[model samples]
Target: MGGSNTSHSNLKNAVLAFLVPLPSILFYLTFLYHYQDDDPNLLSPVWKWCYNHPILLANIFFFFNVNVLFWLIGLIQSSHWMIDPYWTVIPVLLVHYYANHPLAVENKYNVWRSRIVTCLTWVWSIRLSHNYFRRENWQWGVREDWRFTDMKHQYGKCWWWVSFFAVYLSQQVFLMGICMPMYVIHLENKQLDILDFVGIAICLSGIAIAYFADTQLHDFVSRNKKLKELGKPVVPNLDKGLWQYSRHPNYFGEQLWWWGLVILAWNLGYGWTFVGSLINSLCLAYVTVLVEKRMLKQDYRAEAYQLYQKTTSVWIPWFRSPLIGKSKNT
Candidate 1:
C-alpha cells in the first residue's frame, strides 16, 4: 500500500511538473510564430521594440519565463528539481526560436544547416531526457540534485534567497551562453562546407559516446543494487568499457558536443562563441573535483576509486597508467 501510494504521488508530481511550465512554453512559441517576420505597422509598440532586438527579447523572456517563474516554483516546492529536465529542453527551444526569428537568414545553405542542427539537437535532447527520467525513476519534483540540496544545507535560512541567484540566475547565463552558437547559426547563410560535415561528425560522436557511457554507468549502479540485495560484494568502481580510459567519459562526451557546436559557429565566422563551451568545460572541471571528493569520502569505494584515478585520464580517453605502488590485493 505504501509503495502504491508513493508511486501514485510520484505520477501526480510528474504530471504537475510537465503541466506547470507548459503555458510559458506555448506562449513563447505563439509569440515567435506570430512575429516571425517583423511588421512595424501591425505590431504593438512593445512587440515592435522586442521584434527589433531578438536576442534581448529572448533574455527578457528567459528572465520572466524561466528565472522568475522557476524560482517561485522552487520556493513553493522546496526543491529545484524542475531545472534538470529544463536543461535538456531549453537548447531545443533556443535553436528553434532563433531559426524562426526575423533576423534569421532564409537562404538555401542556411536552411540546410538549420535543419541538420535542429535534428541533431532533437536527438541530443531525447537522449538526455531519457537518461534524466531513468535516473529519477520517472518521478519528478520529489528530489533535487545533490549539489543543490547540499547548498541548501550550507546556506541554512539564506538558501531561499541564495537559490535565486545560485540556481535560476546562474542557469540563465549558462544556458543562454551555450546556446549562442544556435543564435549565430541563424544569423549567417554561408554555404555548407567540409567543416560543417566535420562539426556533424563530432556532434554525433559525442552523442554516441555519452549514450554508451551513461548506459554503462547505469548498469554499474543497478548491478551494485542487486549485489547488495543478494549479500554479495559490489564492484568498487567502474573501470571497464569506456570507463577504462577516462574517469568521466560522459562529461568528456558532453564537452565534445558543446565544442562541436562551437566549431559550427566558428566555421561561420563567429569563433567568439567558443567562450560559452569553454566556460562550461571549466565549470565541469570544478564539478569533477567535487565528485571525486565525494567518492573518496565513501569508505566502501575510496581506495579503489583512488587507484582508478591514478590510472585513468580525468576527461579524455587514453591509455591507463601502471598502478601507482601496489595492486589492491597486495
Candidate 2:
C-alpha cells in the first residue's frame, strides 16, 4: 500500500512539473505564429517592437515568463527546482524560435540546416530531461539543487534578492549567450559543407558520452545505496570505464556539444558565437573544481578520490598518470 501510494504521488508530481511551463510555452508559440505573418500594421506597438528585435523579444520573455514568474513560483514552493528541468527545455524553445523568426532567411540550405540542428537539440533535450527525472526518482519541485541550498544557508535573509540575480538572472545571461549559435545559424544562410558534418559528429559524440557517463554514475549511486541498506561498505569512488580516463567525462561531453554548435555558427561566418561556448566551458571548469572539493569533503571517499584525481585527467580523456614512489634522499 505504501509503495502504491508513493508511485501515485510521483506520477502526480511529474504531471504537475510537465504542466507548469505550458502556459509560457503556449504564449511563446502563439506570439511566434502571429509574428510569422509579418504584418507590421497588424501588430501592436509592443509586438511591433518585439518583431523588430527578436533577440530582445527572447530576453524579455525570459525575464518576465521565466525569471520573474519562476522566481515567484520558487518562493511559493520554497524550492527552485523547476529551473533544472527547464535548462534542458529552453534551448529547444530558443532553436525553434530562431528558426521561425522573421529574421531567419528560409532558403533551402538554411531550412535543411535548421531542421538538422533542431532535431539534434531535441535529442539532447530528451536525454538530459530523462537523466534529470531519473536522478530525482521522477519527483519534481520537491527539492532544490544542493548548490542552491548551500547558497541559501550561506545568504540567510539576503537569499531572496541574491537568488534573483545569482540563480535566475545569471541563468538568463548564460542560456541566451550559449544559444547564440542557434540564432546565428538562422540569421545566416550558408551552403552545407564539411564543417557542418564535423559539428554534427562532435555534437552527437558529446551527447553519447554524457549519456553513458550519467548512466554509469547513476548505477554507482544505486549500488552504493543498496550496499548501505545491506550494512555493507560502499565503494569509495567510481574509477571504471570512461571515468578512468577523465574525472568528468560528462562535463567534457557537454562542452564538446556546445563547442560543436559554435563550429556550425563559425562555419556560417559568425565566429563571435564562440564566446558563448567559451564562457560556458570556463563556468564548467569552476563547477568541476567545486564538485571535486565536495567529493574530498566526504571522509570515506576522500583518500581514494584524491588518488583517483592525481592519476585522472580533469576533463579530456587521456592516459592515467603513473603513481610515483617517494625517494629516501628527498
Candidate 3:
C-alpha cells in the first residue's frame, strides 16, 4: 500500500507539472504556420506612422520577437512560459482565424465577436509591448522571471529538465490554449449569447482593474522615486490604492482575467475550460501567497497593507471602500 501510494503521488505530481502548460503546444504549431510566406505590400499611411515612432515600432517588434524566442525556447529546451502564459495567444491567431474563414459569414455575428476579442487583445498587447520596450536598458539574454528563477534554483540538478520545460514552457503554451475562448467560439459559427456579454463585461472589468492597479502602482512608486533619491519612504511601499486590498492586486487581477477567459470559454460551450484557468490561478495564487506573505508582510507589517489585508478581499471586490482613498500625494 505504501509503495502504491508513493507511485500514485509521483504520477500525480508528474501529470500536474506536465499539463500545466499544455496550451503552448497548440500555439507553437498554429502560430508559426502563418509565417510560411508573407504577403508583399507597400506600407500604408498607418504603417508609415508606426515606422516614424521607432520606439513604439521597436516595442511591437520586440514582443513579436519575444514570441519567436518563446517558440525557439520550446523547440530547444521544450520549455514553456510560466509567468505570462498569454504569450502563446500570438500564434493561434484564434480570433483572426474565425474572422476571415469562409465559414465566418455563416454566422456573421460571430465574426464581429472575433473582431472584438482580437481588438481588445491587440490593445493590451500593444500597451504591454510598448511599456516593456520603454525601458532604456532592455536586454534579451538570460533575463530573470522571478518565479522560474526560483524554480530553476530549487531543482538544481535532479529534475532540471522537468522543472524547466514542464513548469515553465508549459505555462506559456497553456496561456495560449486558455486564451482560445473568444477565437474558438467565433470559429464554432454560433451567435453570441448573454453569457458572451457577461464574459465580455468581466474581461473588460478585469482589464480596467489590472490597468488601474498597474498605473497606480507605477505612479506611486515613481512619484516617490525622487524621495528615494533623497533617501526616504517610497521603497517603504505605500498601500494607499488597490494595494490596500491585497498585497499583489495586479497579479490577482491578471489571474482573474485568465479565469475570466476560461469562464467565457466554458459559457461558449466549451466544458471544463474553467478547469484550465482554475489550475493556472491556483498555481499563481500559491506563488503570490508564498512570496507576498513573506515580503509584503515583512515590509508593510502593521500600518496600511496589513489593515487592508485584514479588511479587504483579495481578487473579488466583495466588500470594500473605494480605491480612491487619501494618498501621500493628495
Name the candidate that leads on TM-score.
1
lDDT of 3 by residue, 196-276 (tens): 778777767666777777777777767777887987765455455776665567776666566666665676678666665
Task: Estimate, for each residue in 138-215, the C-alpha lDDT of model 2 and write its tens digit.
Answer: 776557889999999999999988888888998998899999999989877689999999999999999999999999
- Which portions of model 2 show Cα errors greater than 4 Å? 1-16, 36-38, 324-330
Which candidate leads the pack in lDDT? 1
Q: Candidate 2 overall Cα lDDT vs. reference? A: 0.87
- How many clashes in each candidate? 0, 0, 12
Query: What TM-score, to 2 decimals, does candidate 3 have?
Result: 0.62
* Candidate 1 off by > 4 Å: 29-38, 324-330
Alpha-carbon runs more than 4 Å astray in model 3: 1-94, 97-106, 130-142, 157-163, 294-308, 318-330
TM-score of each: 0.95, 0.92, 0.62
Cα-based lDDT at residue 255, candidate 2: 87
Arranged by TM-score with the best first, the candidates are 1, 2, 3
Candidate 2's displacement at residue 136, Å, is: 0.8
Q: Candidate 1 lDDT, tens digit per residue, 1-330?
A: 999988887887777767766765686666666676545558777767756888887887788878888889889878888888989988998898898876789999999999999999999999999888888777676689899999999999999999999998888888899899999999887999999999999999999999999999999999999999999988889998999999999999999998899999999999999998888899999999999999999999998898898889999999988774469541
